[model samples]
Target: MRATVDFAPLFRSSVGFDRMLNALDLASRIPTVDNWPPYDIVKTGEDDYRIDMAVAGLAENDLTITQERNTLVVTGRKAQEPQSAAEYLHRGIAGREFERRFDLAEHMKVTDAHFENGLLSITLKREIPEAMKPRRIAITSSTTRAEEAVPQIEARKEAA
Candidate 1:
């Protein structure tokens, strides 16, 4: 079975895009014909994430990774053959040019990236500001005593 996501609603709706959505749309459309490289997105910690992309038969020089605003773009092109000497019997694996993009959340930054064993690993960390962090309020006696206090009523005299 294959998974399919309908983006017609997304196209119809008026959603505010800030650089990220554009890249995401392009990435989703790129895998329409073929999903060549399998990838994985993992949450490592509270604010840390990892994106692993399988890129076999690709060299560091042939691949390029770039980030603009909150979008990460990856492109790769296999080197052309020097000469078509012998005829090929069977060709199963696909080696072609590809471009992929990913939309990143706000405050998320790519800290480290490494490529090993045909896998490109990218680490992301979201750093929250001090003001944005969860704060604990100290319970004091003043607040508690205010709630316990009773209301006082003044007696009124009837006028002739």
Candidate 2:
């Protein structure tokens, strides 16, 4: 059973959450997508994440990772076999072409990707710009301002 959520009310008040809400709605609708290659998303640190995908029978050259805006795309395609006829009795490892996409949050970028022991690990980090980071503004009292004003008043009276 699939549950439907109406986002019309949310869209009325939210300003920049349309993409996130749309992604959730789209994901809920698509319930029959294949999960051939298993993957894991882990939060390694406060602002760091890692995605490990099981890509057996695939080498580094057979995989391609791309990032466009806030989307991360990982694709795998096995090389064509040489001109030789070889029949397998029991084939288990899947080398089929597959493409997986992950929607990343704003300012999140892919740092590195490496394949080891049939596991493709992709590292990501969220790098917020300096201007966007939280800052503390020092508040001054009104009395301190009046005390500093008295000195400037004396200087002006002497000049007059």
Candidate 3:
């Protein structure tokens, strides 16, 4: 007996099938997705997230964080030093330069970011309005409940 894999069901609906194709294309572009400046993504709470990238030896002025067209760009470049009186026998530190980009979701904006202790921390918060938040509708029965159980004629006479 031979095992048969079913993939037709995946293409039956157009919900996220296109996204899967786009992801496949993107995967083919990048040879490796290794985290250069190792980072951590922490989910602080609902609709709140924090991204911490280890960018040591990088000063506040050397790093830049910007949002462009739903993309979070983090770029860092070390300040150049004069080599007139500096000489190194063996240098193995990786403080050269690097740029990292993170794709942001819709309505997901960066609230704040900070650089401290050689770690660049970027905070993101999703602004979901009251209507956008998930709400539980109150189930009602067919019976009508009176507001105060008052007589209609009495209420009309009082208003007059």
Candidate 4:
């Protein structure tokens, strides 16, 4: 009951975007993927972004955030507790271990992270390198004729 999406047309026009397109294709195929511990991605500014995840029972020590070359991983591991006489009659909040991954674009860097009121906020900024930025080329027009622009080569004389 799933409809497949064709990305052949996009592949012809885009370069270096195969990974992103493939990821989208895979995501479409797997519709029942784990969605525990809901999270939201928000764009605050033109080059600034934030990911806020609601982890009700997890503490700062229970979670780990890692930023690799082009991926961000968020993992939560709940500490095992000793057996208590009090048993949960109706358990609602999720306290299980979970790992979530996010694909990041090039030049994206993680700047800060904050844990407040059962929510983890991760801030990211896009910083393009100086070499990668576009620059204007200088075009100079001189009054000199085309003859002066060419360099003349002199013939070498044979020595006795």
Best by lDDT: 2
TM-score of each: 0.61, 0.87, 0.69, 0.82
Q: Model 3, which residues run further than 4 Å from truth?
A: 1-11, 136-160
Q: List lDDT for all candidates, in order.
A: 0.80, 0.92, 0.79, 0.91
List runs of model 2 lying over 4 Å from the truth.
Answer: 150-160
State which candidate has the highest TM-score.
2
CA error at residue 50 for candidate 3, angstroms? 1.1
Please, what are the lDDT tens digits per residue for candidate 4 over residues 112-131?
A: 99999999999999999999
The C-alpha stretches of model 1 lying farther than 4 A from their native spots are 1-34, 84-86, 136-160
Model 2 lDDT per residue over 41-145, tens place = 999999999999999999899999999999999999999878768888998999889999988999999999989999999999999999999999998999888
RMSD of 1: 9.3
TM-score-based ranking: 2, 4, 3, 1
The TM-score between candidate 2 and the true structure equals 0.87
Ranking of models by lDDT: 2, 4, 1, 3
- Model 4: CA > 4 A from native: 142-160
Clashes of each: 0, 0, 0, 0
Clash pairs detected, candidate 4: none
* lDDT (tens digit, per residue) of candidate 1 on 34-151: 5767789999999999999899878767788888988888888987777878887997556578988777887788899899988889899998789988999977797787888588
